[model samples]
Target: MNPLHRVGLATARHPWRTIAAWILVLVALGGLAATLGGELRDNWNVPDTRAQHGVDQLREHFPDAGGSSAQVVLHDDARLDAAVVDEVVAELEGSEHVTTVTPRLSEDGDTALLYVRYDVPTTDTDIYGIVDPLWEAAEPAEEAGYQVELGGELPGTATEIEGRGELIGILVALALLVIAFGSVVAAGLPIAVAVGGLVAGSSGVMLLAGLMDVSTSAPTIATMVGLGVGIDYALLIVTRHVARLRAGDTPVEAAARATATAGRSVVGAGLTVLVSLMGLRLAGLPTYDAFGFATAISVVCVMAAALTLVPALCALAGRRLMPRKVRRLDTSSPSGSDYSTTERGSSTTDDTWTARWVATVARKPVAWALVALTVLLALGAPALGMRTWPQDGGSDPKDSTTRAAYDLITDEFGPGANGPITLVADLDEVSPGEVEALHREVADLDEVASSTPVSTSPDGRLAVWDIEPTTSPIDEDTTVFLDELRADVLPDGVEATGYTPILGDISELLQERLWLVVGFVVLVSIVLLTVMFRSIVVPLKAAAMNLLSIAAAYGVLTLVFQHGWGSALLGVDHAIPVSSWVPILMFAVLFGLSMDYEVFLLSAVRDDWLDTGDAKGSVVRGIASTGRVISVAAAIMVAVFLGFATESAVVVKMLGVGLAVAVALDATVVRMILVPATMTLLGKWNWWLPGRSSAARQLDDELDVTPTPTH
Candidate 1:
């Protein structure tokens, strides 16, 4: 017996024992997570970069300037009560986390702003928890008829958005499963297995989190990918088991065969996904590495469940997995009756629609291929102009305090007042006169809206200047201005170390390293596909197909999020630059997911080609066999991704929309249409590997005309 089948048989023979062991492990892991899980921090530690170097220098010489700062904005139609202003300032200055507080009054005295500096980085998980004191201090202002709104790191780190997105996604997926598989028992089994896998996977991530810097979003992202693939993998195995049983095999035999066939495909597909995800490590970014590890763990757990747990459940349910009426009909129907091969929970076995569709596509392979290629190119065109930046409070909800503070500041002062770029210099390494001269040059530049007087550290070894740009934080002009300062205006020893410049530096780093990451992902995928399909042409073609679909997804994001095309439909109020990390993360995830359909469809097609020695017929038959399951699985994934699109965070929405679009295009155009059309045109060349014999080529001429059973 095959290894996959042996595992399935052993689990099937002792379902209770297997299930009980899994439950015990889950409980133990959950307890460990509750007590020992480490805190997740958004530490953007991109090494070997100018931004990090500047940060290090600031921390060493000017700790006050290097620490994170929060803004407290107070506005009143009349002059702000002087005593109330002092009270808030005193409250902030009295906090243990606060290192310093500086107050600024607007020209009319109607608005007051306080810049409060903290000892820790704004992204530290500790910051979010210790903000209650500041909120308590602001209550006096609110009671005195003065509107108080907090901005900057204060509001950004205050509270993380909590949503029921995953739960809602699961509910939607279950509905689609019932519609596809008709039998409540059969549909429920996949859901149960998927949820179990998710629990195990999430627990593993928690255990790992206890030792490393996992982002708070890691669990949600892991859950998102795990649930969709878990259900889909289990569905494939269960679908195969039902077909084998209907063919008159005993329960144990049917489970074993299903595990051998679909189970193998599941393992192969899961491994491809894992390889693509693990390729993120090549980017040299810890954030991507954490993402790769968490998601990879989830994929492994689900694949394991599909091999063992799914088979165990199938054996226990036996023929009763179907509705009683449908079971009786399927068992009693004659050989020619439709019920002999399919009933409830097995509607996909009827390949009439898929077969006819493939036949139509085969007649005009060239035309269909060009049509899909053109659509993909058109959708991806906008990506040429895509811009990236860090999202700020300007994109926050209109009613939120952060947005209000940002608006008030922009209305009264310049837009750059919300995020002034700081200039830090070590005067001990250079003359104070030269530092002043550099400051004068910066203040005289055309891009300068205003500049604060240069201030020195307590020992006078360090000098700092806050320079406001003429444009907003997200404006391209701010980046251009920083470039000018670095190239010509600033002295050799002076450096820029503010949030705006640091963010700009990180963005540039990502842009520079983007190609390297892409190369790593494509190379890994090619090697994996070449070995799996046993054909050089198939791997190259798979790479091209995945790239095209991913390009199309990028175009969709550029149009919808960057160009404000249909932005209102997705809860976005205005156009904003794409997040810097979106492209790389999306590429890794989309490439892995795209390969899933490729592996499943080609695995079945290759099997048929070997058995029948007919290239064109095998192409058509392969699509007919796997099209329904792939379509259903893709639909479930799309729903899961789009559910996250409804989230409040802009970054999460971008990821959700991009993944949903990519999966949809891959399933319909790439898998159903392009793969068959291209294979038909390629003929025997599709399967050619090096050192093939003439006898193998000659066998393609002999066709097997026997019709394949739909199951």
Candidate 2:
């Protein structure tokens, strides 16, 4: 029996059994949630390539130096009185984590900046723990007649990471559901299913994070996507089932039929999405690996809920779930078709558009294929010259008083007033003269804007230097300059260690791994497609189509976000180097999502082809039948993603908007027009395989052999 048809038969025969099974599953899931707690981390640890070079310079020069520090800004009155400054300084010094506190005046005399040095390590979680106390101190300072503001890495990260933003996300989701479904009850049901999935999925992530060094960012994104998508898929299935019931089909009959059709589509779509997410593991970046695994797990959980829990809910609600009274009023006396009669005849095959379109496609395959290919090529043009950088310059300068103060300092004390690089050099048995020569060599590099003299360790075994780079620390160019220093400028005897060098090494590693990741994703996708379709030609064609979709998305990203062509309208100004990890991440995510719609459309076509033996009719019918569902799913996902884009963080915004655009384009252009056109051109070649002449025939037999319920 086909798995979907079997599900329908089982539900129809044993509705209570299905409901009982899901209830037990829900109980266990809830119990699991109670035992787990949310695990949170604040830092992204984006490897800074310049850290090593800066450490080398510091070690060769200033051995006694500490690592880089962040400045804490204190917002105060316009006058900048001496008492206020002294009071703030004293309060900072008395704080538990404080190592040193220095107060400085803005040139305009409107703000006082406090550079607070913490004794704790930058990587320590304790740094975030100090934020509340720091805020407490600032509050007293403000009461003492200064409008104090605490701004630094710790403060900024703490503020951003404080809550899950679940409430806001849920509220937004509800609003979108109401707009999409036009029923409060209908909108609420999907949210309930999604929340259940999210709760269960989040616990899974937390447990996984404990077992592996996963990126903290993964959970946040996974929950958002999982909840939104879970609700979307569930809504499609539930709505279809309810519509059937309202049309007068018995509750059991409606559930059976809906499960057989929409259930198959959901499973296909979910598997496609899951496979794509798993593809991210190929990127070779541990962070991306973590993201892939976490997201894949969540997707699986969502799929389970959509398949099981949603059906159970439908069975339990029975006919009451549909607004039957309202539906009856909406259907006037003129169209005297009784609900039961209408529903029985409303099988997916009854739609005339599906048959008519299939005939047209069967007649003109070549023309449609050419048109599809041309459209994809046009959309993919911008990706060819796409360039990426590290920093997405969308942060609010005003929000970070430290950044604001840094801006003021740059205006008054020159741009070099920003943090200096810490260079660490390990000395084995090298003489002072050799060390001095190495220092001179480094100091002469044009990229080294300025260098301070070396400071030796207490045992004279390590040396450190305070070297300032001409470019900003976060700038890609500065990392490149640091790379040149490490590879070309470093003397043979000295080994450098610091923030900059580590960042440089990470960048090089990422660059090297890019192709490997892409190859892995493509390889996996091809294999999965082959297994699903049992045909070499179909898999190859699907892979080609996916690549084109991804390339087009990348091209759009380059034009709008990277090139700053429409950045202003998007509320972003800084042209951030696309993060090194984004391309691989996008490839995995977009390919998977695109494949989702592909599978949903193709499954229907495949089914139809088996039943009628008409290739053209099947493709056209499949596209027409699945088109509405895919469009609705894509619309909900786009809205959810676009909501995330409103966040001030540039990376989140980029990811949100980028995914939104890709999903929208794939749903409308690729799935609706391009896919049908291409399929028309391929004809029987679409089912071709290298070694098997009768593969399509075999597939047809397999489809036909599957069990069907006796109506």
Best by lDDT, which number?
1
- Candidate 2 Cα misplacement greater than 4 A, ranges: 1-38, 42-69, 74-123, 136-152, 159-187, 239-249, 320-375, 392-394, 397-406, 413-419, 429-431, 440-446, 492-508, 699-711
Candidate 2 lDDT, 1-711, residue by residue in tens: 456656665665575786577567667755665565334443334343345444434434433233323455555446666676777678778976677776767666766667676655444566653476666666655676665555444554543532334555567767766665556666677777677777667767766765666665787678656865787778767766765665656656666666776776677667777777776665555677678878887877787777766666676666556554655564432222343234322434444554455466557766766776787788779878765544411233345554565555455333433544555566765667777887887788777777879867777776656576776545666767766766787655455444444544555666676667667767777777766665677767777888877777777788777677777765675555555556776777777777777776776676666656677766876676665556667777777777666665566667776777788878866776667777777766776667764865675556554322222
Which ranges in model 1 have alpha carbons more than 4 Å from their true place? 330-349, 691-711
Clashes (backbone N, CA, C under 3 Å), per candidate, total 0, 46
Worst 10 residues of 1 by lDDT: 701-710
lDDT of 1 at 311: 86
Give the per-residue lDDT of model 1 (tens digit) for 1-711. 567878888888888888887888789878888888766665566677666677777777766557677888889999888899999999888886788888888888999888888887766666753567777778778889888888886576554546656877788888887887777777888889988888888888887788887776777778778887888899888887777777666677667777877887898789878887887776667777788888898989888888888888888888876555768785633333332234322434477788888989999999999998999999989999999887788877676777888888887677888888888787767788888888888888888888999888777778888888888888888888888778877666677877788778878877777788789888888888877766889988988999999999999999999899998887778888998878887888888888888887887788777666789988887788787788888998999898888877777889889999999999998987888889999998898777767676445424422112332
**Candidate 1 residue-pair clash tally:** 0
Q: lDDT score of model 2?
A: 0.64
TM per candidate comes to: 0.94, 0.83
